[model samples]
Target: MINNFIKTCAQSKLSSIYEELLDTSKQALAVNNGNIAKWESAIDELKKHNKGGVNYQPPYININTSNSDTKLIQQSLKKLTPWRKGPYQIGDLQLDSEWRGDMKWDRLKNHIQPLKEKTVLDVGSGNGYFTYLMALSGAQIALGIEPFLLFNYQFMSIHTLINNPPNAFVLPLKLEQMPKEAVFDTVFSMGVLYHQKDHLLHLQQLKTLLVDDGELVLETLIIDKKHGKQIIPKDRYARMRNVWCLPSTDTIHTWLKKVGFKNIKLLDITKTTPQEQRATHWIGNNTQSIKDFLDPNNDKLTVEGLPAPLRAIFTCQK
Candidate 1:
């Protein structure tokens, strides 16, 4: 499948970076894991239920078909559970994932540039949910780069069910692994910046991948400026150990200016809600989510005494 992606990209303006991406993806998939085989098997099962095609069904990326074995489809999809980033629907089966992804889409859809016929790069695209949306919006190509092998398999499972999947593709690679190129017309880095140990470097990398005047859509955790310039969590923020930094919206604007972004615009500042991210049966053994991570006495703060999950969306030109 990846080989076919490389070939398909070779005929486009992205041919220069295809070889590097192919190499990085090969190395990522080579890692051994107990779940790899299981995810692959589940994906194989999903392939059997392919129909004519799929269309963007608003909150649900619905596959269109006259008939389907819904029972088998549900059972097969169950094997790859703990869905974190979607609330998709396949025919009659509603995959009410942990996160209501459409809510995030609705927040920023009207504020950004149109994606039609543009090459888009989605950094840290979990399971290619938004990547699929980008293609649905008529992007020439929407390429998602996710390091997790399981998520890549999850992407394939969804891809196989569609007869002629859109130009969306997910590869097992990170922003750092991508070959330096200014090919993408738009770049998105959502729910990824706080996890980066070096936030500036991540911003720089995002800038490098876009063409001049290309817009960047950045969404990440942020704190109120009244709480101070920023907060570096002592151990964990909302029980997430990898969270390194949470900047104020003002601080984020300063960072963008320092990085040479022009015409920066703060789009939205919204606190995450229980309806948006909560524990669900699909979240596997560890069903904990935002509710569990927050302080029982105070929903405004996390269990660790830091500010609760508040995210900001910003757009700027390179």
Candidate 2:
């Protein structure tokens, strides 16, 4: 039955089955006291399910900004010009004013308050949701670097209509393609690092974009002690290949140090919610499917070549 389900998920392009495999693997670990065969079998099934073509590559821009080639930068800047206003909606998530008064809505805002009046670079500012939040928190200027053309357009239009223009400019280029101008005071990257093929190289690229003594906020999945290896599946989602590499916290700290970041700190750590958990076979907020595969006690698992919780968050400074 399990194998058939896995095969069905593979043939039907279903992600929920992968989530169930993850749950079952975790349960097997708890029962067998670390016997790994069940976990391995589950991962194999997941690979079979994800055997499809990958998502499209994000739009790319050239990064040459020398004095001799100022045209490119000029053209990029022109592309950044804001458009007419559109209907705006207050985001679903709300901030609690009293608990952490005047703090930026990120992992490290409490310890790093007075984030106000600082210029911020929101890397991978999907739809500018967080970008809008940062601007509201008194960030003097927020620059969002998003490579998707449709998202860039929506972010621009939304901000223009909100009566609270993004103090923010949306760049239609990836982080590596942006000019090395020390215009930003801080950098923010969330839910993005794991997507890069060369995570370390991308970290180095982010470092080059920051001014000396600037802070960077990052969040992604990390391998726990229990999970031994990563399992690469064949599935692709929206230009992002579903590759899960869970590095330990210590390993990530080492990477940050290697990239010359200072004052590294683990601000907040939260387990993945079972309903919206990334490792599960479900995508988005498919509550019915989540309830079906829900295993309340089996929180930790070694499946799909990655640890469960399937995601994590972190903050650091450069």
Candidate 3:
């Protein structure tokens, strides 16, 4: 996959830093992990099957193709379990992931600039569902960077099945590891900001990735101002320990402005519900979804007593 990405990058705007990008991605994926062999075996099994054509079929990023060994494919996919960001259709099998990404895509797709022939970066892209959507939207190249090794392998599994895979690829690289180059025409930072210990720095790093007048699509968990400016969870938020901050929409707007982003526009703010995030067999043993994370007695708050998960999408120009 990295070899294919290197070839694609050599012909695109990313040609300038493709070497650095490739080196960094190689190092990131080279980390010692016992599961690497298992994940590679799954991808290898998936590669034996035929490839398919990709399309958008509403809730699913549909892939039209056939596989003689549906059960074998399913079992192989199960080896790379805990799919979190998609509800994809490959041939006859519906790999229902934890999050229905189409819901989030529909909310902001029309609002952003068209991706035709543009260079795009998807930060923290889990398994490249949206990254594939971005590429299908006609981007010259849509590069997804995810730090998790498993998600990168999952992306490769899916990529292996695409008949004529789009100029879409995922690398096991973090936002901090990226070359600080103003090359991408559109940069998407979704579900990533709050994890940062310094929210301001995250916004700053996002800004540095875009070219002059380039667009940025920022999405992350936020709180209503009525709750306070922002809340730093003492321990956990929504059953996840990595969450660090949940700012009000207004507070996030202020942070964007502080980072010198121009024409910052808050595009959408919607509370996450079971329909958008739910458990399925793809999520493995950690079947706990949004409903399980929320307070059973009161839907308005999480089990940890923080406000229910409300997310905001903001679009701005660099």
Candidate 4:
């Protein structure tokens, strides 16, 4: 799979970074072996079944197959459960993920520049759900970078099920691992910034990787200024560790300005709902989701007494 991705990159606008990308991904996959056995086992199970054609079915990325036998496919997918990003459909099987990714996509799709024929980057692309969407949106090549080894395998699992997958490839690499080349016309950093210890650095890296005036779709956890300027979670915020900061929409704008991004615009600031991120049968062992993390008595507050999960989407040009 990686070989095919590398070969494709060689023939596209990403050729300049192809060598470095290959090296970085190889190194990342080499050191990240904790989930290899189980992930590969799941992939092996997936290969036993026949696949189908891929399509965008709004809330779910659907696959249309002539083969109706899905029992084995269902069992194989369940092995790689706790799906974080997608709500995909393979044949008749519904792979409902923990988060309704379509909601986020819907909020920003109309506001952004047209993706047709552009080279794109999707950072923190869990399972390449949006990556496939970008490819279908007509991006020349949509490259998704995710650090998690399991998600990389999950992407491969889905890719394998597609008879002729689009020009979308997800690699086990982080934003920092990518070579600093201004190749992408559109760069998306959705659900990624708050996880960075230095939010400014994250923004800076996004800027460095884009072509001049390239569009950046930045989405991350945010707090209403009524709470404060930002909330640096003490331990776990909404049952997630390594969440460094949640800035206000205004503060996020300032962060963008600090990083020298131009034409900044705050598109939306919507509160996450149970309907959007609820516990599902597919979320493996830890089925708890946003509802479980919120205070049982107060919907406005999290169990840790912090403001409930709210996110903001900001678009800017580098």
lDDT of 4 by residue, 1-318 (tens): 667677778888899988888888888888846667888888887776787889899899998875566877877777787788899999888888999999999999999999999999999999999999999899988999999887888899999898878889998898988888899999999999989998999999999999999999999999999888888899999889889998889899998999999999999989999999988888898889999999999999999999999998999998
Q: How do all models score by TM-score?
A: 0.97, 0.57, 0.98, 0.97
TM-score between model 4 and native: 0.97
| Residue-level lDDT tens digits of model 1 in 240-286 | 98999999999999999999999999999999999899888777889
The residue-level lDDT of candidate 4 at 266 comes to 91
Which candidate has the highest TM-score of all?
3
**Error in Å for residue 92 of model 2:** 12
Tens digit of lDDT per residue, candidate 2, span 140-204? 65656676554555453333223313354555567776555554567888767877777788888
Q: In model 3, state the lDDT of residue 165.
A: 86
Stretches of candidate 4 above 4 Å error? 32-34
After TM-score superposition, what is the CA distance of residue 200 in candidate 2 from its true location, in Å?
Answer: 1.4
Error of 4 at 77 (Å): 1.2
lDDT ranking of the models: 3, 4, 1, 2
TM-score of 3: 0.98
